[model samples]
Target: MPFVTVMAREAPVLVVVTWEKTVSASQTTTQKAIADEVNPGQWKVLKPRKGLQMIDFARLWQFRELLGMLALRDVKVRYKQTALGAAWAIIQPVTMMVVMSLFFGRFAKMNEQVGAVPYPIFLYAALLPWTFFASSVTASTNSMVVNSRMLTKIFFPRLIVPFAATGTPLVDYAMAFIVLLALMVWYSVSLSWQLLLLPALVALTIISAMGVGLILAAVTVRFRDFRYLVPFMIQVWFFITPVIYPNKMVPENWQWLIQLNPMCGIIEAFRASVLGTAINWSSLGMSTVVAVVGMAIGLLYFNQAQRKFADVI
Candidate 1:
């Protein structure tokens, strides 16, 4: 059979291969004819086509060291020259707790709104997930711009930018969780076996954040309008979520409607897992579905948009 060669050219081309046909005439037709048939498929004389890669998850996996470095970089840059450092994480949520404790818990009289749970602890439980979500979303949205140099110069999985950006919040999450532990102790709440599910809860929040972040990162590279929209969206999202009050405050019949917001389920799950509140299975199920759908859509768009980021940015 005649040998075949296939050339892959992205730009100015040099002959990547040259091959000689040694087989007899009865074994195959003319070399050119065989090359046409075999070059793109099996029996290629040159090495097999690796082809353009898709997703490059192995590339992402190989870039774990880079991801860790970026994550650490985020944490350092966040607290650098700031007197409070990591304390700021607790400060924001604690202040929010105080405001809600005064307005919602005291004046609005929502102490018994949810259940027998104390208002402060109830609010704090919800705060943990919300804080992580908000911080992660903001950071991930800006990740591409922040790492523009690397994106243009290197060949790592672009998804790592947003994924790595989320790590700082996860660090803050751990520290704030310490405070949560103390609060649980102070409030005399017992830890349940379900608290072990914290990792899973965090995974869901991260996935959800990445889903939103990838979409925003892609758009931000082109529109630049997304930079402004992020903060506004966070503020609006805060009010819409039951961070200060309980979802139970909403009518029972409409509970499913409220859970349509994916964060609602995450927040509810965090509260239930930590504070031993009742779990809303339906809300949890719905939120999981929404998050998964959002992630799939985000990945698809991010992959599509990634090709143009270097060009646009």
Candidate 2:
């Protein structure tokens, strides 16, 4: 028979056992039973997370390759079977610029509002960013539904879907931007140091678009009505933004109200960078604050809603 001893302590009780010679199968079973009674298996119960949680940026970084692949896939899918291929990117904004220049510039005499810069260059510069913003927002708004198969099949950050949607539009923006450079040269416009601010302005435009895109993407996933609403919203937004006309054309008193629109400041700053006009730092600062805050709120809502996406989507 095996000898068994027990040591009692204030903190915990310890069981000690000694075996003499070869132990029998029944004795081994008894030892295991003792061990099971003393130290039982542990289990972790998982419950749904409540409320907003911090974004797992480390996990996102771990899946950086997946994000890049998704973005590239979007770019490829955009121009895949299109007749115009990538040229459609250059054509859309350029066509809009021509029509706007004819109507708003020549007919309304808005060219004077732009001062030394020709109306074509001015309109195209604004259109470049506007077109990119509109395309990105629309694509992102539809990203969840468009990629529903992946959402149902696999697991990844839902944010990556909308974030990847921006990639296709960014490629479009680059194509259109080359045309803007050509237009600048054609109009005898000289590039200045202010052009260095282009990257910052582009970043601001992206932040604003993503802020709006995130909200719309989340809402659109549950309520499909936004599918029809987003285009009309983008159209209305284009008019409110200083895309067709210069920001200076607005009355001084009402200019502050115009500045309230995030895209207003971005478009104006973009024009200033490319056209060498005076940059409105005050308006830009307000826009920066709004963009950052909007992004935070959108992220919060999206994160909270993402838990339900696998089911809802």
Candidate 3:
């Protein structure tokens, strides 16, 4: 401390000032503080880790609230200023159903193959799951890239980004699901025990979508070409997934190949349950197997890929 005198408007004022004496002393003080905190019992550095078991991200569990917040943020940002807002969800699937109803059901007489179920109702049922799956994949395909800054800066689970992307679409799916119910009632469709399986079927869709999305999310970090590939893939996937025409319309020999698409089982089962049609156990089982397999593979690769995300990002 030092005493100083100043003239304030011709009146003398006395003040005391305190100052750090030397940069060396300041450095010594900081070193002491750090040394005190660095005791073996006091602090330790934790390197990032991935769990050996799939779906066993313990650190991510600690941040579940963060996952919900990120999902909510995306939901708000997604339709913030849209003209129709969430109605866009209803519009996309409903429009596709109408176009298919006109061109295939009415013009081409495709409804007869699905056996007693109306084409519009048939189409909308499958649309619910497909739309959910497709949009989830699309979001995941870009999730890592879009949140590159957060990925680089944050310590949360890498899976949470793609996992969070899956949530916003469910809001859209729920909105679209209401339309499906109206169509079911309009078409005089009846519910049955099969409807009980709807939740299980939806779970499969989420798992499958997340599985595929994880792969795409990991890849999108490295390959920019996926943007174009995604649209083309979605087009091809839609045509093959029995969205417009019933899976029954596909030749019997080709059914096995189509079953290779994990969605084949989910959408078909979804349609059958919604329309009270006879269940196809083989297709459903194949799809379940593929979904689990796809999930395991995606998790394997994603875990390996995530190690480099922050570095490349």
Evaluated with lDDT, which candidate comes out highest? 2
- The local lDDT score (0 to 100) that residue 267 gets in candidate 1 is 89
Worst 10 residues of 3 by lDDT: 11-20
TM-score of 2: 0.84
Quantify how close model 3 is to the true structure by its C-alpha RMSD in Å. Answer: 14.1
Tens digits of lDDT, candidate 2, 92-204? 88888999899999999999887777999989989998988998899999999999999999987788889888988888999999999999899988898999888888888
What is the TM-score of each predicted model, taking all chains together?
0.81, 0.84, 0.82
Q: For model 2, what is the alpha-carbon lDDT of residue 242?
A: 91
lDDT preference between candidates 1 and 2, better one: 2
Which sequence of candidate numbers ranks them by TM-score, best first? 2, 3, 1
TM-score winner among the candidates? 2
How many steric overlaps does candidate 1 have?
Answer: 0
Please report, in order, the local distance difference test score of every candidate based on alpha carbons: 0.79, 0.82, 0.80
lDDT of 3 by residue, 78-119 (tens): 888999888887898888889878898888888777676777
Clashes of each: 0, 0, 0
